[model samples]
Target chain A: MIQVKELLAILIASSLVSNVVLSQFLGLCPFLGVSKKIKTAAGMGGAVVFVITLSSAVAGCIYQYLLVPMNMEYMQTIVFILVIAALVQFVEMFLKKFVDSLYKALGVYLPLITTNCAVLGVALTNVQKEYGILAGTVNGFATALGFCIAIIILAGIREKTEYNDFPEAVKGMPMVLITAGLMAIAFCGFAVLN
Target chain B: MSKSLERLYNGLVKENPTLVLMLGMCPTLAVTTSAYNGLGMGLTTTAVLAMSNMIISMLRKVIPDKIRIPSFIVIIATFVTLMQLLLQAYMPDLYKSLGIYIPLIVVNCIILGRAEAYAYKNPVIPSLFDGIGMGLGFTVSLTLIGIVREFIGGCSFFGNELGWFAPVGIFKMAPGAFFVLALLCAIQNKIKIEGAKKGKDVSKIQSGCNSDCANCAIDCEKRIDDIEITQEDIDSTAKINAAAIEKELAAKGGEK
Candidate 1:
């Protein structure tokens, strides 16, 4: 049981110091693919936030109560993936029924979230770091927000680059990767703040 | 000489998972900060990929259709955890540097994508070769990127000090990563386009490894290997398209 202050620290650390995509490379697929369009980026970000938080919270508890007690901690990866896959399914249904607008924006990307790696990455990291339930959940939520921030910023940049006249060879994917490198350099500035 | 050898050739070049197929970008980018790190990650991934492909191929028929993806994930996660323990016990330094990536292999697209697209459908021998070919392809690209970054950024090649040009420093940084990878890709793309002008197939060297597995489409190139993707094979492979195919075959009565 972490205090409120420590929880905030974990959140900030995950969202910045160790960003899931930019620094850690946990969820580069959605980062590169969805970052092409702001709308899809936001939609995918929303789904990630939902699924990662819910799954991590549940995974933390399972690790704490079940795996720890049973000494089957080695099973963390398999167990967390199973939870995440199931949680993603539930979140998909919940979004379609309750948040119809979000449903449409993120409908196609929801299933993809199951295999996004970031979600499972968080769950496993939380276990590896030995964070308690509440702390792990906060870290997971913050990591997804970090992903959200990175993708939206990349999308905004990409949207502007659409009109520029890049060299023929450096036009599409190559240019985008170069842009990400620059963004990563800029983000590295945050390392000082920590 | 044989179909198995063709599969190996296809994986190494024709359908190189890293350079051409573009699967598993996360590790390719994050871990390639140093040549030694890159080689360690690449070899670890290769071992897991080869073993998992063999196991998955052997048990392909046993796994139920409705729960294939989850089952595959379970299998992959188990292998990854096993690798993690082995690495930690033997190579603690490498394991420490690799950190979370070792476990995150559970989500590496190459392993899952190959298991889904090739291993699950093909026989055990070819699938094993496909895994090796693809794994070797990934290792080669990763080591290449690692060598470039290490030499340019740190003034070393495979950890040996070169004592040559001044290390630019940024070449080892994240932006440098993007630059080197982009440079390689751009050159490959240029060659491919130029090759196409000569009526030569350059698809094999077109692009670098990209992770497109989480939401892979039915027509993903990885799925359609050198083995011509017939309608029946496509239907069996893609769950999303299976329904549509059922309705189509039902309506068309063996027409397509």
Candidate 2:
């Protein structure tokens, strides 16, 4: 039986201890790309949280119902990616029709989300962990939250760093990366929680 | 000959897949803990990239415009699955080292980026070379990052088992990946800055320039045009002034 406290711990651990960004390094593309501004970072974070959670749940269902029953597990990667691409397209169209402002804000990133590994990573990781529907959904949601928290923190820090004086060599991306390194080191302290 | 060479050279330095474009950071950071794993991952990706690019270029005409994205995903996924199976069957050690990243190659922006940007428009021969060039560029960058990280974090070069280097364990961890990537980006920026300082005439490098020069110039020119149109010369000056005065008074009263 999964206790509420255990679920909370899993959420905290996924967000801080085994962060997909700082720990596993699963989605550094968007981490570095969309992190220049906190607003955009938050938008990307929300989109990621929505995509990862939704895709993982869908992927888990498909894996459990179709692939596992038919013994066609080798097709998991292809199937998951196809599913993600379709989902991204659907989300993009839906947003454009119903939420024009959000569509304008996300703009290119909406399509680029198709290539973001974090969504696929969450799905594939759920399969690897062999979680049931509820567990997979919970893990997926928690992991997405974890990703959101990490990116938001990094974005906040990056916003502050942009104004600070630094060497020319380490001025832009290098300093952001160095700050990320320090954040990763700080997150490492959470390893003891497990 | 030089055209193809230019394409090849562009992938390596001018339009580096990783450092400049920032295309495949997931696997770049994940699998670069060791030099050997990095090389293996890089070569595997290159092989897949070349094969997929060739096929895409060969079939670019037949592919429907409506379903292009799905078609590309299928082609890329096929090659990635083939690579996964081949690695599992032949190079079990390297396969194990790369872990989930081998399969994660499907979503890698570099492979799909090339297929979409280069292969779709180019001929087969040039596309093949482009793939090889870009793949090699990506592989070299990943391997370099891996070597630096491994040497610092493990105190060994590709598991040398020698007692020569000092091991900083952070290099083997996630934080080490960030540190190395940051340093590499810094070095890359420094090189570009130095190249510019040397008067190399890198006007073509303006492709990724985020400096907003064009927009700024347009805005400045628009301001000058506005200044040139004095109140007496303007046809709607009275109407415009009345609207502006009313808006200013409204704002002042609203604040009060």
Candidate 3:
């Protein structure tokens, strides 16, 4: 089906050319903050992945089934934000109840993801692109995957940055931003394919 | 200084949403491919921030504490939608360029953060001015970054072509955004260091609810030092840097 190819393109585009952290800058807060350690970065990325994937699908469905029928196209921002916030909160509670270890890793970040622009951005992009639920879900997953890939790589680099003697002024966030710049440059190779 | 002016100074410099506080990085980095884009995004966010701050401050008493967060989001989102429609109608080019970012502004931490931290607690006028100051701070910083990126990457400023050196294409791309921002932050750190060495008192700044807990507050009384390094954590060089930035922040804080 044509849907399959469309899905593949969305996946490739979001994960590479339009990467959430590197290119689109949707999740820079967590990218810079949590990336201090590989473990935390991976944990945050996993939570975002779960959250974004489900949010895109649910938001897409809500728009298609509910908002469209009610002449409420303008309510997209409010509706999507509420849905994503509720969903993240629910996931946090659900994880706390059933999966203690996973929750511990991602516990604090759950509430944080509610305000993260990426989840909301993905949902909005899904609407703008007019993609069906299936494609939107795929795009959301791929975008979050891109976030993980970039954050994990940055975390690896940051771990190494600990050994190097940074200049007094270039310590902390400045150095990390520079490292991200280099990584973003490497990712730019994908733009050619786009 | 008057209370109203203090709030403006706080948002503009002392607790700048972009530079000092680091509240909203998504649009800050993504849209600064050009100075014009940055200006457009900055002004749009300012309008939304100012309006939402006033509206939220007005409703602060009515909205109960338990549901405040959700209420604030609705208030912010509504303004963002209104701004988007107006922009779409009046300035289609700017609208086209600043597409998803307009909607993304609904989740912009600066607007939501200010609403929760300042507007909810403060009176209507001070909160409104707070929004303006923060919005101006964000605009200035974003414009500066955009100018840097534009000149380096696109070899232009505000869409105006400069008939000079070869444009480094990288500065216009994603990597360029990171590189330019890093360079600016480092320069700022240098200024902060020098200011501290002069033997002056200092205060610090915030962003993001997840990691930078000390700086990003749902309330105004954030303990910035706990989140960032104190005077003791760094050596003489960094200590001086901290003082320098603080001096600047305090001066700005007091300017009003």
Candidate 4:
């Protein structure tokens, strides 16, 4: 029997305890790549949150309705990526037509999101967890929220770090990484919340 | 011959896909917890990269320009699937260790970047070598980071449980990955600065100029009517400067 409480627990757990970035380390590229500035990081985070949530639902439907029935589960990776690429393209066009501001804001990051591992990771992980469609979608949204939260927080830290003093060797990427390490360590405390 | 060899060598050191370009960090950091895993993941990526480069370079003329990105994805996905199957059948343990990263290779920027930047313009042989060289550089860097993390975190090299070495335990966790990576990057930075100071013959760096200065000069010269350091430009420049120190080091082969 799946309880609502258990769903919430899973949602919270995936976001903080098993964070896509800090804990699972699935999307370090964007975490490090985009987090240097809070604005771009927020934009990237928003794009990821949007992509991961939608892709999770789509991937879940594909897995349950198609792959499992045809014994083509092994093709999940290729299939998921293809779906993601198509979805990103479709969304880009849709946004460009309907929401010009967001399209411009997310410009480069929108396409880049198609390749971001966090989105793919959540899709595969939802499969791994054997989540039902509803559960998977919720988990996907929550996980993306968690990722957005973590990255935004890291981006804020990085913004502040720029003003602070750091060792000459540890000034830039090194220092930011160390900050991420601390953030990950702090996030480790959330394991107890489960 | 020498020119092609120079391009190959440049990919390996001066313009490494992983360190210098920072193209494939997701797979590099995620899979490099141990040297064995690093080697496994690295070689798998390399094989896929080489095959994809050859195919893409050959088909560059035929593919439509507008649909090139999607075409590149399709080509890379095909090679990634082949590698996934090969690993699942032959090297199950390494396959298990690599986990989802094998498939994740489909999206690795290094592969697609090569297709767009190098392979599309180059001949098959040079593209092939570029793949191998970048792949080796990635493998070497991953192994180096893995060695440090494994040794410091678990107090074990590879998977051997050392009785004499006390495990830090943190090294095995996610944060350890960041810490070790950061330290390696710092060391990489130090080496590059030292090399530049010593006047080593590195072609990657434009010695006398800052990145913003170079870009500014280019923008000014190219677009005389346009504004050169817009707010967006400033933010990106700041980001570039922050990342450039480590990039300079990675270019010098001081990290791996």
DockQ of each: 0.51, 0.47, 0.47, 0.46
Candidate 3 chain B, run of 10 with poorest lDDT: B214-223
The docking quality of candidate 4, as DockQ, is: 0.46
Stretches of candidate 3 off by over 4 Å are A99-105, B205-256
| Shift of residue A174 alpha carbon in model 2, Å | 0.9
Superposed model 2: Cα runs more than 4 Å off? A3-9, A95-109, B1-10, B203-256
Clashes of each: 4, 0, 7, 0
Among all candidates shown, the one with the greatest DockQ: 1
- Please give, for residues A1-194, the per-residue lDDT of candidate 3 as tens digits: 88788788899999998888898888777787777768767877898888899899999999999999999999999899898888888888899999999898767667757767888889999999998898899999999999999989998998887879889999877898889999888898999977
Interface C-alpha RMSD after superposing true interface residues, each candidate, one decimal? 3.7, 8.0, 4.1, 7.0
On lDDT, the candidate that comes out on top is: 3
Instruction: Tell me which of candidates 2 and 4 scores higher on DockQ.
Output: 2
- Give one digit per residue, the lDDT tens place, for model 2 in A1-194: 46667667767777777998888887775676667667767877787777777788888999999999999999998999899878888988998899998777664455646756777888888887777776677787888787788888988998877888887878877887888899999999999988
Residue A5 error for model 1, in Å? 2.8
Model 1, range B105-175, lDDT digits (tens) per residue?
88888888898888989889998888888888888889989998999899998889998989999887767
Candidate 4 lDDT over A1-194, as tens digits, reads 55788778778887777888887777676676667667767877888888888999999999999999999987888788889878988999999999999888775577656666778788988887799887898889888888899889998988776878776667777888899999989999998876
Q: Cα miss at A113, model 4 (Å)? A: 1.5
Pairs clashing within candidate 2: none
Model 2: per-residue lDDT, tens digit, B118-237? 899999989998998899899888888888888888878888855776678888998888888888878777777888899875544421212221111112223333444665557587
- Flag the better candidate by DockQ, 1 or 2: 1
